[model samples]
Target: MNSHTVRSLAYLTGLIIKSFGISLVIRSRLGTGAWDGFYVGMAGHFGLTVGSWLIILGIFLIFFNSFLIKSKPNFFPIITIFILGCCIDFWLHFLNFEPDGAESQVLIFWVGLLFTAVGISIYVQGQFALTPVDQLMYALSKRFGFSLMISKTIGECFALAFAFLLHGPIGLGTIIFTFLCGPLIQFLIPRIERMLFCR
Candidate 1:
């Protein structure tokens, strides 16, 4: 494969790791941050494990993405995400990452969620196939020429609403994550890209 392709794969691999860590934190059930709050809530309502719900969400996004993005959808990230979710579920099942109980679990959850945002930034920097949520923003941006920030805001608002209707966890953490994640991802994307690909 070309250097570009190889770099993209490496970045995707990193994303899986980061996503898995976030999943692990969620299953710990101490406390979840904003996005995780929604995810966990959806899982609870559906009687699905958090990891399974994540995989389902990723798969659903993959389907939605085919119609939403400039780039043709690829199954690699979806497949990778599913595998990572399963792996994370297993890790949480067997490992005790949170020993201090609820409060400490919340601390770890936030840390993991931050890392999840960072992971997504790195993955995007790879410039591989966009994930579903990203694809939606991309489609909107291309269709209306919305700024990236604007498109992202629109998408997040929609996600917030949907998650809320599903009784997904919306709280102070959700607001914090919604506001901070965009800027944080924006900051990390370029930095990780430069660090890894020197581009």
Candidate 2:
């Protein structure tokens, strides 16, 4: 209706597109991408569709993020991620392609994760409200006076550990994801913003 509304819609659409890419990467069956291993493993355990799990997690994260930042959840990205995640999951049913082995799969996993890093960088550059998990990290760092990077590392480490316990594939991909995502995001966010928005 207004310029602000248009911008928000655009940003939300970008996030959903990013989420759709993520779902495609996950469905690749080469291996679960680093960030997705937790969600996929949980989905497997619960016998629910990955999209269903993603939607549920997205809702919870949005609410939780709101609590941390006092920011209200918007409808666009929330609904988009939910519906697209389910769409991706359903689409994945007809395709089946697992990696060659643990080693080969790990390589594929790393590549998929690199793509995720790029996607995250682009998403942050959009400067929409932070995702729930990102917001939680921001809130924790602000309240505890830790560096945002450190807070993120701590949070990811915990997720990595849980993923391991759940028998999710953890490998060099995990290590690389943990070590590299922060600096990469920091570097790319600004560049992407400038390129996309000239700011």
Candidate 3:
């Protein structure tokens, strides 16, 4: 396969991995990533699949990101939206196993976090389109000269505030994921880039 084919595969694979991780995190009943939590709240309070909210909010971010970077909005991540939304719903429904206790829940949370970071890193390396939320990090980084880590942390904080207002599940796991995700993505992306791109 050519580079494009490889990238498309990686992109799709990463979305699946990320969605699976998201399902596990939600199922753990601990907490979820900030934006995922917001989506959860929206889905619970309003009516729609979590994926549906992800897509809707992501569309809003497209213009938000464009305004930040002072560029024409990129519609590429709309693809990311549809694919990821569908996959997340699929995993959320398909996975029927539940954590039996706090220890199990914590284990699942950590595992899910790991999968999420890895998936985000891998799909980013695909060099197609970053998911809209992830793209927000890039926009902020470009506009503000923040590191990816800082950019991501800031973005999640904004999402967290909205999640709180929306009455999402906010707890230890939410805080942990918020703090860890940025560093993990920072640490993993370079390593993943090397693995995928370095000869």
Candidate 4:
């Protein structure tokens, strides 16, 4: 296959794995990451699936990010979001994995979080288009001269606020994920890149 095809496959694979990890977190009955918390809250409020809310929110974020960056939005991210949304629902529907109790829930949540971080590292290393949510963080960071870390924290805080207002699940897991996921992603990205591309 061509390089483009290979990259596309890698991107899709990463997204599918990410979706599975997210589904695991949700099923664990522990809190999810910020954007996911918002999506789950919106889904509950609107009587839609989490994946449906992801797509709807993703479309809005695409336009919002464009406005913030004062540039044309790259529509390619939509493809990633669409596939991600579908995969999330597919995993949720098909996977019977769930935590059996409080201790198991904590274990499951950490496992899911690690899986998500690894999946994100892989996809980002592939250098395909980013999801709209991630694009928003990049746009804000570039536009305001803030570091990406600060921009991401601010964005996630907003998501958490919305999730709280919408009454989504919030717990220690959310706090843990907010603080740790970025560092984990940074730590894992180089390793994943070496694994995938070092040959």
Candidate 5:
């Protein structure tokens, strides 16, 4: 295989790890960040799997992002989300350990959170398609002439509102994770790149 193909496979492996971590976090019953919670909430209220909702939302965002950026919709990331969605379902199905107590729940949450962060670092650091939600963030920033921070805040607020409406788990974990996740991913990215010898 070509180097690009090898890199793509590695990125996909990272996505599988990330998806597994996401399932663990969701099953912990603590809470995830807004976008994830929104997907989980849809899965619970509607009649689909969490991974299914993830793909649906990702697809919806692809169009929404296209509208915002005034560009043609890129369906390439659908392939990425499809793998992620399947991996999430696979992990959710096979992961049979339920949290025995609050302590165990916390343990699961932290472990999953770390894996999620590291997996994100590994894949996102590579030059490849990212989630449509990420594209939405940039689209919003450009369309409204807002900064990335402001655009992300707007996206988070909208997602949080929708998650609340869906009765998704909105708890301390979500709040703490919102604060912790970005910095953790940022910290891990460079180290992971060095380890992987990626640019």
Candidate 6:
């Protein structure tokens, strides 16, 4: 296969893994990551699935990102968002695993967080389009001279506030995820990029 085909396959693989991570977190039933919390809360308020809300929010973020960057919105990322939304719902339905107790739930939540970190690292290393939420973070960082870490934290805070307002599930897991995921992703990115491209 050509290099492009290989890269595409890798990207898709990463996305599937990412979806599995998301589903695992959801099934843990402790709490969700910031964006997932917002999606779930919006889903509850709108009477739709979380994946549906993901798509809707993804669209809005795409436009918002365009506004921030002062460029024509790139619609390509919507393809990733649509596939990601479908994959999230598919994994959630397919896995059908649940933690039985508080200890088990905590264990599962950490595992899911690790999975999410690794999945993000792999997909980002693929150099394909980012999801709209991530794009927004990047735009903010570039436009305002904030570090990516700061932008991510700010974005998560906004998501947390929106989720809380909408009565989403918030707990220790949410707080942990908000504080740790960005740093973890930053730590992983360079290593993953080298692994992917240094071969």
For candidate 2, what is the lDDT? 0.61
Superposed model 1: Cα runs more than 4 Å off: 1-9, 24-35, 69-77, 94-106
Cα lDDT for residue 119, candidate 4: 79
Q: In candidate 5, which residue pairs get closer than 3 Å at backbone N, Cα or C atoms, i.e. clash?
A: none
Between prediction 2 and prediction 4, which has the larger TM-score? 4
Q: For this target, which candidate reaches the highest lDDT against the unseen true structure?
A: 3
Cα lDDT computed for each candidate against the true fold? 0.65, 0.61, 0.92, 0.83, 0.79, 0.84
Best first by TM-score, ranked = 3, 6, 4, 5, 1, 2
lDDT string, candidate 4, 96-127, tens digits? 77677999998889888988887777777557
Clashing pairs in 1: none
RMSD of 3: 1.0
| Residues 1-199, model 6: lDDT tens digits | 6557656766787778788887788778888998999998898888888888899999999989999999999998888889889999888888787788999999888988888878877776556888898887789999999877788888888899998999888888899888888888788878876766675
* Model 5, residue 117: C-alpha shift (Å): 1.4
Runs of candidate 3 with Cα error greater than 4 angstroms are none
- Candidate with top TM-score is 3
Checking candidate 4 for backbone clashes, the offending pairs are none
Residue range with the least summed lDDT across 10 consecutive positions in model 6: 1-10
lDDT of 3: 0.92
Over 8-98, each residue of candidate 2 has an lDDT whose tens digit, in order, gives 6545555654555455456445434444667777877887876776677767767765666566765444655565566557646743566
Q: Candidate 4: where are CA atoms >4 Å away?
A: 1-6
User: Which candidate model has the greater lDDT, 1 or 4?
Assistant: 4
List where candidate 2 sits over 4 angstroms from the true fold: 1-17, 20-35, 67-77, 87-95, 100-107
**Winner of 1 and 2 under TM-score:** 1
Q: How close is candidate 3 to the true structure, as a TM-score?
A: 0.97
